[model samples]
Target: MDANTISHILLPIDFSESSLNAFETGVAIAQKNNASVTIIHVQDNTFEYDHTNLHGNHKIEDNFGDVLNALADAAQLKLGKVPRLIMGEGPITASIVNTANKYSCDLIVMGAHGASGYRELFIGTNTYKVIKYASCPVLIIPTKKKFKQFNNVLFPLKPLPGVLKKYDLIRCMTSNNQETSLEILCLSSKINDDDEQLFEYLLDEFKERTEGVPTKVSSQYSFGNNIAEIILKTAEELRSDLLLLTPSIDISNKQFFIGPYTQRILHHSKTPVLVIKRNN
Candidate 1:
């Protein structure tokens, strides 16, 4: 994210505290980047209606539009910029994606909870859906918290096939000015005993490629600690600005963010998380 360019920003508000946190973060980002925001509210009134009642359904739909308008007006005032509040008759996730594409938003900001089981299974998390479908970057703010300056960033990379290529892109993204110094931390828990030799080569290659970038590449072999736990602990100790990693969507197309480790982190950690999704 450059300091000067903001193109467009999409914010999904559900009136939840998490959503409001995301909205405030979006406002700060947009204000800094000089970008405008679009707020979207989807009305799910049909869930209360008796399917057989046709006349009652029409009234519900009409009232839904009115609710959207009111929410939009209130949001616009809070954002300090008039936002386009869009309403459509459908599921939340689909409507959000459709509205974002319609406006060509460059970034999507939303909140997520540590939901589990049937609730997540049936409703399909709006944040997860938006991340999978949005054409641009998505930033997930966990709760109502102010963003700390991102001085150090933990970027975990496995030698998975295309990992290097994505690492290259991340290096470029983190290479900002000297004031915002970023330390790139990479770790590997598997030990080959001959791992030092392999890492020597990998380290040299990364350094050579990231020359002009103001970043220090640190590498380590995970020592008896869980991968995600190590990451969370490290970030907490360093007070990192954000946790940057790539999520590999599994066969179910669900984001396997370090399996349940990510869920645990989100449930407990205060640090913001930035996930870069890449397709092979």
Candidate 2:
């Protein structure tokens, strides 16, 4: 019911329009929870690691601070406080992941460039690069997507056990309004008898937890070979504002989280996707 669930949020921006659009989402989340926000911009300067040129790097960061300060000033209008800024130097994705880990950020909100009309790293593949390596949850907001209330959510999960540990995270991301609701999409790759039972059980378990909460929760079971495609279709039909994924699969396991299944959803989903890190 409160942003206390999120203490600090890390935002990586490139000054691109898409990145600027994501600024609203990151700031909005901070404003909601009274949480602190840190805005980071990574510059892939080749000579950054040269200790001899440390002074030059410092000068560059000082210049970057000027722009970051302007951005912080603008964000203050919505955040009600000046956000801390970090001028990172290194590879785009690595810098982002390392900064989040170093600062102990609870969440990383970044922009996702659309299918066509691409600009740079935060687009198609590079964005996923950061998502796969981040220590915390990564929320991808599309360039054209509008920032609105988090009343409706679409959560998809497998029948695997121990995947519901972050159900509380889902609740915190949504509002407490009466009309606020969580839609659970029970996804199955086939019509196996055991998986079907587990699907129903997962749905009912979450549904029961909404009894006294301000949000209404409902679920639907879906069977298909192409689970990702089915999920995208369901999200469109429900007009979901956010797509939440909590997989039992670990990032390092033979069954990869960045495999084709999750990759398709993150790359193509029209709605924003919140990928909860396993260790988070």
Best by lDDT: 2
Predicted candidate 1 versus true structure: per-residue lDDT over 1-280, tens digit per residue: 3422556788886555566677777766665555778877665544432222223335434464564566556656665777776655577777887887888776777776421221422222657667666655666776646542344666655544444554543332232554333444445555655655655666677778667666666665554437667777877877776666565211123543234554455445566666555531
What's the TM for model 1?
0.64
Worst 10 residues of 2 by lDDT: 47-56
Q: lDDT of all the models against the reference?
A: 0.58, 0.72
**lDDT, candidate 2, 1-280, per-residue tens:** 2223887889887655566667778787777767788998877664332221223334434455676788788878876877888885678888888888888888888888622246433345557888878878888888766564577788887777667666766665666554676887777666789988887788778767776888777888877778778888988999998888766422245322576667778778878888875656
State the displacement of the C-alpha of residue 155, model 1, in Å, after optimal TM-score superposition. Answer: 1.8
Error of 2 at 115 (Å): 14
- TM-score of each predicted structure versus truth: 0.64, 0.83
The global Cα lDDT (0 to 1) of model 1 is: 0.58
Among these predictions, the greatest TM-score belongs to 2
